[model samples]
Target chain A: MKPTARWIPYFLVAPAFAIFTLAILGPIIATFGLSLTDWDGFSTPSFIGLENFVRAFNDKVYTSSYGHAAIYIVATLVLEVLVGLILAGLVSAKRNTTFYRVAFFTPVMLPLVVISVLWSFLLNPDLGILNRILDQVGLESWKHIWLGDQSTALLSISVISGWIFAGFYMAIFYAGFQRIPSTIIESARLDGASELQLLRQIKIPMIKNLTEVAVLLCVTGGIQVFDLVYVLTNGGPYDTTQVPTTYLVRVVFRDQQMGYGSALAVILTLVVVGFGLIYNKLRTKDDSVVEY
Target chain B: MFKGKRLIAGMAVGLLGLAVLTGCSKGDSADKVLRIATPSLGDSELPVWEAAKASYEAAHEGWTVEFIQQDDDLYSTVGLPTLLNGKNSPDAYFEWAGARLDQRVAEGFAADISTDIESSGLKDLFNDGAFAGYDSGGKLSMIPRARDVTNVLWYNVDMFAKNGVTPPKTWDELNTVCAKFKSLKINCFVQGNKDLWTVGNWGGHIISRVAGEALYAETLQKKKPMNGPEFIKGLTVLSDLAKNGYVNESVNSIADNEAASLFFQGKAAFHPIGSWLVGTQQDQAPDFKMDFINLPAITDGAGDQDSIMAVFTGYIVNAKSSKKTEVLDFFKELYSPENAKKIADSGTVLLVKSLAGGTLDPLTAKINALLDGAKVVVAPPDTGFELPVADALNAAQAEVIGGKSTPQAALDAAQEKVAALK
Candidate 1:
């Protein structure tokens, strides 16, 4: 290529690189620096030198927030990922599945704030439709304050998250199901394989790459969940639903403890990165084993 | 080709420089703007605010009045700070008078407005006691706007009459009334503890009565332990109400407005909230007959039974603002006699002594009477003390009210968290 032609590509990417540096990289670097100081967003920050990190480790609420996130991640894996795979299999087996596909994917199109607010009203104990329906059906014994009780608040949020994203995962897996060779599926059916057997043995194994991606997406997305939880629970019912982001917001915004909040943000970033790395490593090892 | 490359490079550099400049740029300062930050007002009072703005701008040529209104919850917590730290901070901002005001003053955001009040003749409108606690060694940092009795037991007048029960005046009587309402298949008391402050404010008053006002202040101000026996005793008052199922079962899940809806729909017999409820009811439930009474007296209580949980909320001139004179002029117009009357007619209890009487609604007049008779005025935990300590106490109250912990256990957990704050 000519020398000027070689410079064209670099010129085209420069603006985006500058934006990335200003918006993303700058904040990351600033957060790291702020993590080492005692600043309340107004006063001049004084060097505190890892005291914020020490306090975070000792902070019960901040540390327990991770435990809540773990529960949420596991729950989403089942409700969003596993459930989506099952839904995809069921929908793929049916003829003319457009209606089912559209109905399932509808929640994903709605904004998270709208979904959270909608579910908050539906779950309200006194005047909410959920409890009222239970009473009307003579199932009052099974009714609960779904979002208020500690035993149920986080799980309820996970269920709502599942409801919103299960369709997204299903659409992904359904596309994968469509990409499977029709001849191989027909041959399996001709050999007397049941639909379930085709899905479990043939279809799922053929879509291993898609499943890996879906699981990775679910795990990371669960870790960074904020808006839905903030609107629905605000980490309430005695911090039972306190995830890392909600707790970070409370510390930084509400309490104005910017230094400590930045430290918490850094810790959360490390955990997310660590999970991503471990997942990639395990996937790569599995791929090698299969090749051998 | 070389010329084209240089053009591309110049465009990229211009884009980067533009982004940097945009991020650093402040709002237009050449317009002679007087900006104010306040909590979003309801429909009844918003017109008055707009009128005040128009009046101010009309009186001063080339002057523009800008109001930054935020949701009530956000205004008190994150929103105000974010705005104040931004490049175009408001000239004046609303703040509750207590530790929050003191924090702003300490952070150098509040200007001493005493001289402005005197020179502007705003001092003649309010009583001397209205400026109490606003002065830090005679440096007045805030101008009083409204005095809010933060928590009062507002009962449905028709519901009480139908049930043949009078308003409760003592602890046992209150419990009896709740029991009677329960027997009638009515929710006795409905509160949205979802944000924790509803129960936190009410429970703070109960704590003040049981543990005494001084100890309540001492514990929440971080000078004493929160899990003391008297504090535990105070929490039990709230826990028993929860255990008895007097409050709505979804208290922790719903917002304050939702709980107010239950009360308005006659599904609940009583709602405990701030003085703002009167105006809210006027707008939201115009026909619902309601009256409020002070919290019931506790027998053998260490504190004065007549103590009321109240807070003074007003605006502080930003110390960094270049338009202090403009802000004062706007304030003078905002609090003029006609606007003050409009605010009063909307069921708000203004701190202006001249408009206190003869213009209030019947319910607001009763509230003023309560204020007049209050032996001591107590500030709620969240507005009166540090945020962390307030969070701890509020969470403890929520835990106790939600039946998640015994009062002792909850206060112990809270004390642990408060200790960690040090």
Candidate 2:
């Protein structure tokens, strides 16, 4: 390769590298440093070693938020990934695939803020049509003040978040379905293999990598959940729906405890990165790639 | 190959140009332009700010004053910190005068405006209580804009009269009034507890009334436990209302405006809110004549019955600014008799003595009367304690109202948190 050609690859990647360094890496380093201090956002930081981390582990609110996040992760993994795969299976089997794709993915196009606010109105116990419909259908006992009830608030938020992103996950799974060669499926069908059997036995195994990717995305996204909970419940009705990011906000901004907030943020990052790494390790441990 | 070399060189030049264009700097000349940030966007004081900006620029030649409006939630937490940390902080910034301003003052973010106020005769312009929140070791830290009292009971006169309910003067009377309204299948109090702070405001007032100001102060200062008899008594009032269904079933779902709208639409009877509600009612619920009253006394309570939850919102000069004199000039213009009158005319209650004599709106007048009658105006519990404790208190109050936790249990948790803070 010519010197210019060799440098061209570096040149093409330079802008992105600079941006990542300045915007992402710099903040991560700063946050890690800040986590060891006891500074409010305004004051000069006083190093307090791992006291912030110690306090976080001891703090009920912080630990409770992590518990909420765990619930959210399981919820998203099931609702967004599993349900999305099912929807993808249905759409991939359909004649009008484009229409099905658009219909399923429509919620993904709307802003999450809009979706959360809209869901808040829809789930309101008194005025919302959801409760009214339940009343009309003689399922009045099933009606709930979904966002206001401590037992249901976090799950309700998770379901809404899942509903919003399910379509995006559907799209990913659909693409994976499309990438699968039709010849094998045709042969399987000719051999009297049912649609459900094909999906369960052949398609799923072929798209295992995509399924893993979707699970990773859902888990990491769940760990960082903030906007939906913030807009809908604000971790209210006794902080049942509180997540790490919202708790971090309350600490850093509301409590003005930047050092502690940074510690929470760092822990959250670690949780996400840790989950990703563990999931990757588990997936790659088989040392066998399922060839299409 | 030669073309590729030229292309690489060209890309390098373009990247440098982009850097030059996007690099951070003091974009505005400090001498030529003054920036002021406020949490007033279409709020009652927006017009007052606009008018002040126009007037100040008109009075001074070659000096442009830029007014930046930030959302209240964003401004209090995100905007202020970002501005303070940035290379070019605003010359003047709006702030809620409490622990928030205290934190800023402690960090030396605010210029000590004591000398400026004293020399400019602005010291005598405001009432003594206006400086209470901003005072640190006998120095005024910020300029007080107005004294805003929370926990005022704003009722629709028609609804009250229609229900044959008079303004309550005692806790028993208030309950009776609520019962009357509830008999008619109407919500007695339109509470926007969804915000948590709205309900927290009521909790603060109730605790202040039951425990007395000194005990409440001691509790906040960690001398007394939050879960004591005083707090339980106060929280029970709210819990009782919730249990009796006097408050809306969806109390935790609706916002302040939605609750007030219910009151205006005749679905509810009372709105116990801040003094700012007068201005809100003037603008939004103009057709409804809001009859204002103080919160009824707790029967045989130790605290003063007339005491209310009041706070001051004001401006602070950024210590990092190079244009202190210019910012001070604009602040003087903002609080001038003419501009303050404009603010008061918008149905806002002012702390300025000069603007206090104006022909205020009847609702504002009634609110001011309540403020005048207040024997001990305490800050909200959220403002009294540090943020974590205050947040826990807010959550505990929500728990009480939501039936998620009993008053004793929730307040006990709060008291434990408060004790630990000390």
- The best candidate by lDDT is 1
lDDT against the true structure, per candidate, is 0.89, 0.80
How displaced is residue B393 in candidate 2, in Å?
1.1
TM-score of chain B of 2: 0.87
My TM-score estimates for the predictions, one after another, are 0.93, 0.90
Q: Model 1: DockQ against the native?
A: 0.63
Q: What pairs collide in candidate 1?
A: none
What is candidate 2's lDDT per residue for B294-361, written digit by digit as tens?
78889877888888888777788887777777787877787788877887776655577776667887
Give lDDT tens digits, candidate 2, residues A228-269: 998888877677788989888878877788888899999988
Top candidate, metric DockQ: 1
When summed lDDT is taken over every stretch of 10 residues in candidate 1 chain B, the lowest stretch is B22-31
TM-score of the second chain, each candidate in turn, equals 0.90, 0.87
Write down the C-alpha DockQ for each prediction.
0.63, 0.46
